[model samples]
Target: MSRSTPRPEPFVSATSAAALNDLRTRLRATRWPDSPADAGWSLGVDVGYLHELVDYWADEFDWAAQESALSRHPRFRVEIGDLNIHFVHARAVSPVGPALPLVLSHGWPDSFWRYSKVVSLLTDPGAHGADPADAFDVIVPDMPGYGYSDRPTGPPLNSIDVAGLWAELMRILGYSRYGAAGGDIGSAVSRYLALDNPESVVAVHRMDAGLPVFTGDRADLSPQEQEFLDSSAAWGSTEGAYAAMHRTKPQTAAVGLTDSPAGLAAWIVEKLRGWTDCDGVIERSFSKDEILTNITLYWLTGTIGSSMRMYNANGSIPSEQHARRVEVPSGFSFFSGDLFARPPRAWLDRVANVVRIKELPRGGHFAPFVEPELYAQELRDFFRPYRKALG
Candidate 1:
């Protein structure tokens, strides 16, 4: 590694035998809740489904295999400021041209696991029957208080702060310039990275435009944009309760989530099912192993509370950030099954110098994981024009 690139210590994800035993013990001891005779998922996580999942987790799901699978990638840890961030850094094997350095940020209730499926596809597109010129030196980092990264002991770090850390991380990796991409909270972080460091970020791509960043005159919005905002409000009225809890009373809610492994699964699996193209069945998008692996990471790391507390920190971002327009080149992919309605291209143009926008026929919020090939293709195509700068 170059002297400018901080030496990344090799890391592995390991769960002790005792920890596994304890988890099984917890599962065995779980006191399942009752539901009405016909209650399916309308109330929340279907009780019958939860029972089936919990049984699989306790009896069939293999943590050892999942851990080994995650460790198959070159995982590393480096201290960025006060937090020791964990990330997967996979370099292109063979490139038809210069491999663009790309950083992928993940959203809530997930970690680097969100990008694990796409890392190799991004790094070696030729193996997947695409042009080797599309390869990227992919870096997928676990945000502070998420995954194996250090949880905040003090005030939580907001998206802008996290964006600054990401910029520094790319610099530490010996890349003075790079592309950024993500969805959900990661979308917000990528937006800030473009806004705060337009000079260094070659371009940015996101699955969503993020919360309305425009605070300007209402007259600027097209009728479609107005309708989108109105529908967003309507969606929030029903589907936004979890965010409100995260923003306001995360600690109180964390107590139960931390104590009950099943409770943790209940909270997260609902989002996975609701936000994906999985219809009402989560397994359509994520296997039992995949779901358990994610939930287990949170359970073993004991970072769910710290992760939720980030919402509290985000609520205090300066109003200017919301008002600022991102000058860096931007791309967006609106997957049809996503929970949030696709924003009109007019609305996206309002906040970003959008160079590309595509509405995919399928996929959802967790596109990288659920639709890795399509997601990787979007990144490769969107960032192709900017690869010359990295040379």
Candidate 2:
């Protein structure tokens, strides 16, 4: 704890009764949108399903219970640079060795809520039947402009910027060395943490290499790399309209998402179903309560807009920055059901000094939430060897 760094105040997740009432009122008053006959989910979020989900949300969902569940872990908010960052700092319960400090970053359409299920699994692995020696003092932060954290008033902060903030955050917490892991936007931030602060970051783990950006001559690309770019392009044309909107005209879409609870649910829930390994049945992966809890966080915090703007900010990261390779020991996990086109080993090798690669049998883009036990074990296995370096 430095004199310059402000102290972190204990925080809890509690929405005002008035806000909850307004949400229910809006959910009940939602004007339904018509869909083509037997549309199902072919044309965006299924209307019939949305109707049922909204009905449940308005009449049966329990925000208080969800809030209580979220607050069960130790949470705090502290001013980090210009933003008031909120994070969960769960220390190792009973360590058999020096517990490794791990910072987990999350991506869009989700907040720290993404890792809630796995926090205890990581912090107290002994109770979960894992070796206490593998325990991690886990830190999961809500990215700026998301969740309970303060929204950015100026330009959006990109991954590089956020990585710097995380470094400072770890320093403030008295950690001289730590491990970094993330999925989606978090993967980029974790990569930059290793890139920007190589000495302090013990190891880096990322789920994907992000969309391919060929900074050099097309002639130089390997065949597999070229295929990845083509596949990513195809995925974008079909499945990335929401991201395009987030990058270009987020404010326009945010207007509706911010105001209408149904619209917000529809926009986010669609991704939840499409991205997870649910095999077309969303409930197979997430119950209605789980789905609504995430959506309700976005609605209550009014952060959907700011969260979207992050895409816009990231668009401006220099091409050179995107092309930079990380020399720090890096690990990659490509879950079987994630973003259809898994990055080729050649691509991963080109981007970072890859040491470990795991083709997980199950799970999808939201691996932590979808398979907490599996995800926890993956982290424990990957970071176990690195713990010796912590000494």
lDDT of 1: 0.90
lDDT of 1 by residue, 213-236 (tens): 446677878999988888888888
Q: What is the lDDT of candidate 2?
A: 0.92
CA displacement after TM-score superposition, residue 155 of candidate 2 (Å): 0.8
lDDT of 1 at 330: 93
Clashing pairs in 2: none
Superposed model 2: Cα runs more than 4 Å off: none
- Report the lDDT of model 2 for residue 321: 97
lDDT for each residue of candidate 2 in 1-391, tens digit (9 for 90 to 100):
5587789999987678999999999999999987999999999999999999999999999999999999989999989887899999999998998999999999989999999999999999999899999999999999998999999999989999999999988988889999999999999999999999999999999888888888677668888888888999999999999999999998999999999999999999999999988899999989999999999999999999999999999998999999899999999888877875888888889999999998898789999999989989989999999999888
Please report the TM-score between candidate 1 and the true structure. Answer: 0.97
lDDT of each prediction vs. the true structure? 0.90, 0.92
